[model samples]
Target: MSEEDPDLASRRIAHESLTRDDPTGWFENLYSAAADGAAVVPWDRGTANPLLTEWFEASEPNGTSKTAVVIGAGTGWDAELVADRGYQTTAFDISPTAVETAQRNHPDSQAQYVVADLFNQPAEWQHAFDLVVEIYTVQALPIALQATAIQKVGELVAPGGTLVVIASARAEGQPDAEVEGPPWPLTKATIRSFASAPDLRLIELDESPSPSNPTATRWRAEFLRD
Candidate 1:
């Protein structure tokens, strides 16, 4: 028999979680396993996402005197980048191990790392951030949960705030049946749901070749709240 794929353990944990009808639970399982050296988090790149950096360069967002949050902050590279940009940043993950690791990864990090569920966030977080960065977190859940996830992410943006989403993109009409994933790709229509909130406007949505895979597409969308 061929050796198991390196990410098979993570996929198995995700599948079991999904089978239990717990879409977000696998995250803690995976992160805990990684912490114990029994498995690895496939998405932990150990550096700030380049797409986010590209956005920062292009938009020159002035985070000074602003507040930001990084959803599914993982090991905190993205949160650190946002903190470095001068925002009072709060980064959160559903997994406590992940949050602890992020805190450990950046000992002197300015960002507040917390264990927060995307589905049930704190009351204070409602429309409370000037910037919200959601990189691949929504896509990591089942496709059926996309709309609710998008709406919750949007609700975090304060008046005049901006929300940036980066994720793997699929063709608009692509069949969901064909996509088996712990990382289900998002389509154009699904992405538009980010602006479904009455107060949010989709300012930009770009579908381009993924930096990690030239043939695969990536979506970098930006939304602004009224």
Candidate 2:
């Protein structure tokens, strides 16, 4: 018999532990550190994601009248870019520290930065946004919660509006191998499964090596609410 892979077993255990409804207090701590102006989030590039910017510039000209909502708007980079496209953008994170930092960083961008958890979004937020941008947020949670996140994304979009997601893609059956992570990688099939919900219709799915990290590929998906 083949020897058991300890690494895979450990990963499963870790994921199972993390998937529970642990209070999001740690997220608040992260924001607090950032608010103190010393914390450096690994995913913060200090600027908008270039590929996302490109997509916006290309699609904005053809998009319908709609306000944009950016989920997990860490540090406001993507939110700023979305606002630059002339959309009325509202961005939020569960961390107050992150929201404060975002407000400080983009003092003049007019992007409404708020602190809100996706799992329990305010009732008024339902079906309120025309454009929903989901970037690196779903993968932060355990794989089992991905469907919940995807459902929330759909809930935020207005009828016939669009939802765009950007995430790191992994190979099938390979569990997350990182020691500790906020930027968890997900497989393309997993992403498709999330986007395949009844309320959202998949429009496009594109995969290419991330320009910033040639060793890893990124998946960009566009979905429309029906």
Candidate 3:
């Protein structure tokens, strides 16, 4: 498949997997096909997200020896950033292929890459990390599952720990039903929900146009567990 054009076959297979009531199966199939550059991963930015990096720099939390978890770790770029900052990072994906791909991509990485479902995580992982980074993962799921994903994301933050959420932004009255997506941009209200209905408070919430595409925007939010 050409990098310029995403392989529709892979996407179709993934969508069918979801249609079959297998949420994680689509990710597995997508990653398996993406191996060896055979298919394009639309969200694989190929580098640690700049928004996350900047947040780390601004906060300068003493991450030394602290634990961090990167949700939907994909190819591990975000996890690598956390590890490099001195945190004991666990980068997990529901897709075993994605975990394996990340390990292969960065043989020297200090981050521990694992295959695990976000909805059914390890017992010890609940409220286990000093930091939890959720970047574009929740929005990737079907709208029906976003609430569950949001709840799980909050569950990972330890007492007084931090949560960073970065995702595409959806306008207040955009009539989302008309849009087609595996990546449904998040609305401000939905983003705020992460700060509420849970024991967390919003620290900062910013929405701005993506530099790459001015017409498209993103929500960069940070929250603190109470």
lDDT of candidate model 2 versus the reference: 0.75
Candidate 3 residue-pair clash tally: 0
TM-score of each model, paired residue for residue: 0.96, 0.83, 0.93
Candidate 2 displacement at residue 106 in angstroms: 1.3
Query: How accurate locally is residue 75 in candidate 2, as Cα lDDT from 0 to 100?
Result: 87
The local distance difference test score of each candidate is 0.91, 0.75, 0.86
Which numbered prediction scores highest in TM-score against the true structure? 1
**Model 3 TM-score, all chains together:** 0.93
Local lDDT at 99 for model 1 = 95
Model 1 TM-score, 2 decimals: 0.96
lDDT of 2 by residue, 30-145 (tens): 55544554344556778987768877776764433569899999889999888877778889999787888899888887789998999999998898888889888887766656
Q: State the local distance difference test value for candidate 3.
A: 0.86
| Poorest stretch of ten by lDDT in candidate 2 | 1-10
Task: List clashing residue pairs in candidate 2.
Answer: 31-97
Off by over 4 Å in 3: 7-13
